[model samples]
Target: MEHAAPQAWLLLALWLWPLLLMALAMRTQWRWLPALGALPALVSAALLPVGTQLSLPWLLLGTELELDSIGRVFVLFSALLWLIAGIFVATLMYREPIGSPSGSNHFAQRRFNALFLLAMSGQFWALVGVDLVSFYVGFAIMGLAAYGLILAYGDPAARRAGRLYLALTVAGEVALFAGLVSLAAHSGTLTPDPSLLAAAGGPSLALILLGLGVKAAIVPLHLWLPVTYTAAPIPATAVLSSAMIKVAVLGWLRWLPLGAVTWPHWALALSIIGLLSAFYALLIGLIQRDPKAVLAYSSISKMGFLLLLTGLMLGQPDLLGAGITAMLFYATHHALTKAGLFLGLGLYEQNTHQRRTQQLLLAGLIFLALALAAAPLTSGAAAKYLSKPLLQAAPWHWLSPLLWLMTLTTILLMARFLWLLRFPASKAGWEGTAAHPTESSAHFELNLLAPFLAWGLLLALIAALPWLFAPASFWPTNSANLLLALALCALVLILSKRGRNPLATLIGRIAPGDILGPLERSAQRLRTQAGRFQPGQRSTRSTESTRSTDPTSASETALELKLRGWPVAGALWLGLGMLLLLLLLAGAR
Candidate 1:
């Protein structure tokens, strides 16, 4: 109890510091602002013990922050990524100052920093907040603030991505709000326990799932991911992918009654949907030209795996403890590995002129990609090893074969990602291809060295993760999947070399955001057709004018115009209001 006060303060500072720095970042563009802003959270995650609770009853009906085992892991990995991304961004800004030659660029940089810090704060808040209201508020803030990051360049593609992101964010928020309200009303508390969740209705569950599914990038709700990832700056994309999307899974763990009851139907349905999300993303991802878009689909596929774990837990209450542990471990591993890949991609593109640097960057990218693909002895393999128990324990017999298929597809997806990096899009876009080439002398400077070191540290973490989580025996057991994937990849390569390339025609055939194009065109067509029925058009005006000189026709037209006017509309509204009041009064008895 003597140490409680300091721990409480540290917990508060974790999120508060970022908000304070966000304000400072808006006024002055400090290169280290991103790194500095994330420090408190990192420190808190490192020092605070699990089960440390800080309650603020006076705030927002009531608010509580706690660092459970899951929260600690989430905060630790997420803050680490945010810190590394910050360092990377700061290095870029240092080398090419944002304020040089143009106030517009400076302003844009400042806005990006501010939004970045705000999003970081919201991420921490959502991760630690134990109450439903606090979680929802943080989740909403994080989701909405990311729009600014996605819109950083203000280009047409960025604008389009931003608009789509904003629309989906708002829709998700509305659904979440309604779901939370319904859940709280039924459960009689903001901090939901198993009992509270058990009392909640299916509608609340569906609403909450729909709302969080958007953030999770579940198939139909995932339209924003590919485009937004391709358009957003590298650092923004890294955090958005690694940190923000993972929050949806955390929310599920916190709110769902995984171990309390069995819902076999919901379980089966979610499992199927999860499988679909995995395969669907894989198919679309394989054809993507942009590396970032491929990663976006990869994220979708990984989230689908987590969702599968969730469904299994819902059905088999006994698996909750092991399932939670596996999911957290997997999420942490993916987060670090994916962020490293993005950062390395940025490094590769920036240092393209230097052969040695390009080789080193490519090597690092391949290592991370292999780890992401669950190659033996890496973090990804360990994650899969951890999940085997859950998969085996599941009642469904077909899950094992599906898991194997997913693994094979994941390898293909990663290969596609690496292959596309060799031929980056010629158009000057977010990868910084349009920027001037860096001098060889600049390679060893502090600006470049710092980002490399940060990235290196992330790589070290990824390599060490498997040992930290699994035993020595687990490493040797998972080599079968890796072997099969490699053999399949080799066959495809040989086929391509023999002048009968199967995938040659499929490259770039399907655009990013696969269904979005058709949906948008259909919407545009509907709007065009709807325009034909609108009143007061030129044709209608011409017809009306032709009859204006005849007395009866003029009288009728005048009456029609008067009925369309505000005065007549107001009278009709009043009449409807009175009728509603009379009906209510009569029904009250």
Candidate 2:
């Protein structure tokens, strides 16, 4: 352990070095350095031992960081994502035209690298930190820094997404901070680790879940995900969905003591929420036309499955060890596969000229899609194999059929994603400049090769994960389940191809953010109504926007104006808090 201390210092350096590099980027012209910024973190994660610990007594009233089993895996994969995204961004900077102010790409490049590094550093530290305070610090830093990445393009849509992201982030942070403070107060320690506390009460658990749920983008809390990812750059979307979102899962694993004590109510509630989110995302995802939007909903659905697993673990505390291992495997598989899918979109968009290259890219996309859909012999199958125990257990037996349905839904969504990719939303301004039509075939080939190679390596790593971690004999038993799921997916596909599918209309009619669209419309109505009721306003129903000919419209408008002083939103927020408190009290009983 003493000898391992040096490597742990490397872990600290892993995060801190990014900040130093970020500072350097502002002063230096070298653009290649930021691409390599994630290298140290990757190295540190590879070399560090499982129990390596480091304390920062001088910082934040003394904090501790350690590379536990879960942390080790998280840091390794997260660093991998950061490294890949960094390379992609660096390459892209060279391709894109310089921004304003005398045509210098320096400002654009520097701004992105600085924010990217800050977010990466926060991700690394948040995973490595053992104590609650340290974790929250890292979490908040990452959440705040990511807003810049979303707003990098400075488009109207990007700005809107950034605002929404920040709003949700602040709300989540407040919930988490309050929960952490209350937990510490209850435990009589300012720096309580998950293991130090008993089974937390319902209020504490609910608050933590509410906070992290926003980050995780679980169902009703998932509106920001699609909007932001669709508007952000490809690299930003890749890392944001693949690596950043999973940090919330890690928070749940650490903040809540899974095996320490059982709370069936919280567990059951989480399972219900998780399952609903999964189904909702799938149904809405089927209608999504944008490739990135499809991917975003896919991520939401995947996160919901993870939430389901979390519930299973909580419900049956005896299965904690297996549950955690399953979750880690599932996370790893999803991260790699999902990131590959997102990055593949970039590859598809880049090669628009050559038919051969396009065909090859399509093949690769299908392969990646199959991987994500958990085809046999893939990492997804291995992960599913590991998680099957959850359904096999008592009281959770019903989840078996539901899990099967979820898998089918996932397959359908993946099919929709492939279909959407065929006709991506056009790059409005960069349509002609997006690809160099006259560029040499060799250069285009090389550019295409780089991303595919990255995907290939990641897929290979995922394929080998089961062998490296799980028993060698597990694959044979898992094959049958995989085949059955594939068969069902094929049946669905065939029906759709023949134009006989009954659900096609529902898929086409429903938007990506299924429930959120209506909620937003309702809010907009409220705002409009609130405006009309101002003192001394025209009593003629303000026929400016609405027509004077429609009597019903005028009446409704008048009624809305009359009731406009109501604090609907504020009251809703207050009611939500009260509901949570009531749930906690009930759970305590």
Candidate 3:
């Protein structure tokens, strides 16, 4: 029997190897090597048994790495997704024509590969590390490295998206850093376990939620996801949607006192926010013309379910086991299926010339879509059944109908995605080269099969798991639910064909990243309005008129003047502090 001591290095390799590959890529010209970088992690995840631990006292204030149950599942799916996405990246680099034969595109490809490996390294460590500092280090690295991937295309939109993503990521990082410091300080330990944080409630928890919530793509904080993922390279988007997003969910699972503490206010608030985000993404997705944008919105919608489950766990701590299991299973299902769908889009772009190939691609699309919708026999179905008990419980019972409604919307959005897939390549922003007559169909088939097999294998695993280990009742055999979902899917497809999708048209008016546009416009208008008021000109205004001409403008100018001065702003802050002091004193009485 292999002892735990011998396997200590495996945990380190799982994360460090990618960084090694990243460094090698920076120094070498070989483009294909980085694609194989994830193999070590994948192999380790497959062979390593649970309960493996490695303690490093030399690391920052003593860090530990372990493969617990959650970490194992996370490593399995994350390594698998990264491995496949790496292959897809290699394929794109090799086959796709990029900006003439000049080596400039190759240089960009090299940069992309390095960044990809760095991001993968961060994601792996974030899940595997047990310590707070280790997790935060990994999370921050992943967040920063992904920005390069977002701007890989170097387009105007990609630049804009990269800036937006970076801004939110930085804000989240600040919150997360502060939260971790608070968590450590309050708990009186640098190496804090999540269970210990149960007593360290308040701003520590709130700051952590705000930080991770941004990465989780929770409502309002989620505007960066659809924009960034949609603009990133296809392979980058694949791992991003399938793997990187899970980091946030895992962070919540690892850092928060989910079942350990009762937080009714935050729990209810999170559940409500989750529900709104789900429907919000679905509605926005219906109108999007870009297939990638639709997938991004769909990802945000799926994330809402995870958030809801997390909230439920907070309320019903006794159900933590079930909730976490459901989340793991759901994450696994989404990672594979979503990655497959992205590659499916890439496959179609590459093989659009052949009629037979197009049909086969559509079949694959339907398979992935149905699985995502939680149709019978799919992994999503298993996940849904596992989570059903939680959703059906007390206060959450009110959300049950909404859950089904969300499913209906999911089916509709998937249908919309499939419908939009039929559009011309240019409309979808596909950059595939036309298939040469000499290019064999087998070549395209191989590329397409890479992601499909990954997706299909995951479905098979989930389906067999329920039958092999779970009790008969645990199977997703709710025939009525499946039937209802299928009927809704069919109804959506039918309505879509006759140009009678009135709801889609009406909801479609709201663009992808719905609130961002208005927010941006409002900010710009504020800036423009601010420019109209000269700083010293306020004195001139007072000299010119004895009577206030425009109360609104005068009030705005005065507010700006107060904000510009340190003394006035300090006095304002002092007055607010006194007010808060009085309120706290009164409350204490």
Candidate 4:
């Protein structure tokens, strides 16, 4: 069905609702209004299907809002995550109080409510952004407001985390701007065709790759992730992992010209990047003590595979469509699972002894882990299974073993994640403060468990639903995936003995990229060069004195102009007039 054009005001109103609600909340001191207003977006998303669109010609900046199958998936996932996070925040505000006896601070609903609305507006604008300017407008708004959540507390770690987050965010946005401009220049249209990006082969592709690559935390580009993941406050961390990262992924999907001709070198290079990233992050993640950092690396590792799947789709467009479908589904699973885990940590830190149903929370985490790790039954698992079929049809059959190694690496990293999880909640873990309760909270348990239960049911349905829409492919698949996942879990259980070992450090003993060392070297070289060229200092004084000592006669001879007379100037003007007169005489003839 053809989508009808929507009113620009409607698009504006969607975001404006949050802005207006925020203003009203500020005046009336109603904290819940922002969260409540967020719900209407969900309703709008559902009601305003693909056939619903609007265009506002009168407005200085035209606005648009509609839903395609892909847009529907993107918006739905974003809305659902925001909704859940909102509920979690609301509960914490009500139950935890302003400042608990344990001395951990809680947020005033109004303050958090403002930030939440701002983020929601940004997210809404991002999805509805049909034009480049608007899309960026939305993205920047979301990115900065997100910082509010990250550095909510003025803690040292939060301060460092915010710096790194801001630096990388700046880099990604700048690089993305280059690609967006290049895309417009080549396409010759303000409105972009998602598929037309397929034809973009050179710098345009690189800029997009580097730009989105930073945000996606693709291998070497991923420096800030673990730090910020561990340091950002809970609400901020959840939004970062769940919502913010997905925007980057969506940008990649939307901005790239997937419908254009495939460049094999780029495709192969991307696939390699994906594989390397998954393995590299897994190794680095294994040594982390902070549970949140482990998840951060885990997020990086998973995105690597998703990026790989995206690259492979270039070879098989039909199968590419299928891969994208599974990829989107998996993205949803990861957001929920990751957010749940972060909240789990926040809960655990609340009490010294968690008498709550910690087992249920643990189970929920395991399912979430499996979901991200792409274990069977869960969307993550199905996504994994689906991708294998897609890959088998690709040209590189030899890479399957390497691909399996990637999966095995995921299992290994996930095992380590579970291990990291245990150590943090235990008394023996790395505590920034020597005094911290290993126990979590009931509210936290309830918040996490609800999502787990919902996800578990979702997984069960996924396992059954395949027969309904997609016909099963004929293949004798490697059935060891689930067994491997479970076996790894069992190993962690048996080897929980690592609790006695000196727990790993959170900050890297050997920081990847040697970022600081290079900066130091570059600074020294710059200083040395600046000293040599110090224009008004001793160096310049010596050079000037040497020049001043030169003979005045030599300088006078050099300064003299060869053609200085007015007679020559007048003769040149007469010649120009003669040339014009000759041209006019020839025209008369």
Q: In model 3, what lDDT does residue 247 have?
A: 89
TM-score of each: 0.87, 0.84, 0.83, 0.75
- Arrange candidates, best TM-score first: 1, 2, 3, 4
Write down the lDDT of every candidate, Cα atoms only: 0.84, 0.76, 0.77, 0.64
lDDT of 3 by residue, 297-369 (tens): 9999999989888888888888888889889888888888888888777766777666676767787788888
Inter-residue clash pairs, candidate 1: none
Write model 2 residue lDDT over 335-385, tens digit each, in one string: 877887887778677777766666767777787787777766667777878
lDDT of 1 at 208: 91
Clashes of 1: 0
lDDT of 1 by residue, 1-589 (tens): 2345666777778888888998898789786898888898898899888899888765565778888898999999999999998987788655554435344467668768888898999899999999887798789878977988998767789989999999999999899889988999999888889867977978998899999999999989999998899888889999999999999999889878889999898889889999999999999898777888899999999999898999998998988888988999999998999899888888887786666777778889999999999988888988988888889999999988998989989988898787777655322211113333444653554557889888988999899998977888777755777788778778866776575666667767778888999999999989877766777545646766778767988888789989955347536954884785566456534
Runs in model 3 deviating more than 4 A are: 1-4, 97-104, 423-500, 504-508, 535-589
Query: Which sections of candidate 1 miss by over 4 Å?
Result: 1-4, 93-104, 423-445, 538-589
Per-residue CA lDDT of candidate 4, range 148-255, in tens? 566655578777777777788888878887888788778765457855565554788789788788878897778777777877667567778887788777776777
In terms of TM-score, which candidate is strongest?
A: 1
lDDT of 1 at 547: 85
Candidate 1 lDDT: 0.84
Best by lDDT: 1
